[model samples]
Target: MNRHLDTFADSIIAGKRLSEGEAAELSATSGTDAFALFLAASRIKEHFLGTGIDLCSIINAKSGRCPENCAFCAQSAHHATDSPVYPLVDEERIVACAKEAEAAGSHCYGIVTSGTTIRKGEELDRICRAVRRIRETTSIAPSCSLGIIDQETAVTLREAGVETYHHNLETARSFFPSICTTHDYEDDVETVRVAKRAGLTVCCGGIFGLGETAAQRIELAMTLRDLDVDSIPLNFLNPIEGTRLARADLITPLECLKTIALFRLILPEKKIAVCGGRERNLRDLQSWIFFAGASGTMIGNYLTTTGRPAEDDWQMLKDLELTAGSCRE
Candidate 1:
């Protein structure tokens, strides 16, 4: 074991955040005891957030027919995976799903649409109305993941009572082109900036297991740090059949733990969540993600894939002796 690893772990244990160089070292570490790192990260999570899990759920309010050619996405028009192309869900349906998410112990319900941007007019109008209705009728915070958003749209959503805006960076700047040619990484950064400028909490994170080298993962984390994102949703790639990256191997649970632990060390006070693809990639060891400094999670189904049921996730929280509560439920 590297002596520096223990020293880095100790800094976190002592309630001191890691320096950039220290965070780089931890993210670059491989072949170490991942569980040991998880233990250290669990201490960090417990210190900052206690044993509470901020549970949220997401619905693909609008799906398929995305113009972007993101190689890992099942919803991209470039992929042959069967997906339904639908206009945004009606406001009534959006509100109803928020109610269901509340009943399932999720405090936040995300409205995700597959596209390059959520531009002006009617689509934005319907979304805003839905957000307003949810705020008035339920306790759930309406989080939006409607692709690239400008400053004005961000303000509009904020005024409509939308709380957080999720725009994932998806990969390191250098490695981004290999993943998606249709949109660049800087575009994603600007959207986060817009969201924050509008006084909305920015939930941003990248997916691992996209064939990125360890250094690229660290680069992505440092980028997130620079942006001062409020929430980080760490996703492991769940390679869907027919997508270009479908044959990509699953990221081991150990790798996932290491990433989460490093993220905890890097963003000591921000919300770090175990998001999409945890179930398939983490297998039976998903419980340890919380122990590895994940303070939150997307509890129900993901955008194009089925997630573990809400009851199962709730039971996992109980087993871990963690309290689960949110705006809705």
Candidate 2:
């Protein structure tokens, strides 16, 4: 293990945040030094967040026909992918999905849609109704990933029973232009800011393995740290068949674990939920996410993708002796 890695980890453990330079150094580490980094991150996670895992699930409330030309997205209209395309489901169906997530022991249920922006209209009304239904009937907290949002819409979602508003940066500012062109990177940042200002806990994170360098990953984390987001969902790229990133190779499991540890080191106390692409990317090393210092993870289906079964995930938690939920079930 490198001396600087230990020193930086010790600094984080002793209540000091990692500087951009130190974070870059950590991202540059590989092999055993990186494994040591994971250990140190696990310690920081246990010290700050305890061993309880915050489990969340999401339903693609609406699908496909998106105008955004994001290279990694299968739902974009510019792509020739076979991703499911449909209008937003009615409130009853949304409620049913929320209830299912709750029953599977998920602490949060997010309603995600495929679009550039989830504006105010009938779609908004239906989402509000679904949120209300979930709040009235289930213990699971309601959340949304309704694209770029204004402060007014953020407040409206809050009043509609949304506890968190998820708007992923998707990648670092420097790398974003290569990945998506329809929306500006600053728009994502502003959405998170507005969501936070409107009294919603911001769940902001980015996808990895989109041809970004390790330093770029750290850059995204720094941006998230600055945003003071409440939850961070670390999604690995899944390379849908028709997207521009379809031929992009998958990141190694070890690298993914290291990335999760880096996220823990960067945002020591924030909820780090390992979401989309875990199944293929993590493979046999999936449970290593907990060991690498993730505070939570998504369990069940994903937007345009299937995830590991809830039962398998539950058993993995049991095998690892880690409690599930935002705290405990």
lDDT of each: 0.86, 0.90
Give candidate 1's whole-model lDDT.
0.86
Per-residue lDDT, model 1, residue 305, is 86
lDDT measured at residue 133 in model 2 versus the true structure, 0 to 100:
86
After superposition, candidate 2 runs with Cα above 4 Å error: 2-4, 327-329
**lDDT (Cα, 0-100) at 236 in candidate 1:** 96
What is the alpha-carbon lDDT for the whole of candidate 2? Answer: 0.90
Which portions of model 1 miss their true places by more than 4 Å?
1-6, 13-17, 28-32, 325-329
224-316 in candidate 1: lDDT tens per residue?
A: 989999889999999988899999999988889899988888887778889999998899999988888899898888888899888998899
Top of the candidates by lDDT: 2
- State each model's C-alpha RMSD to the native: 2.1, 1.5
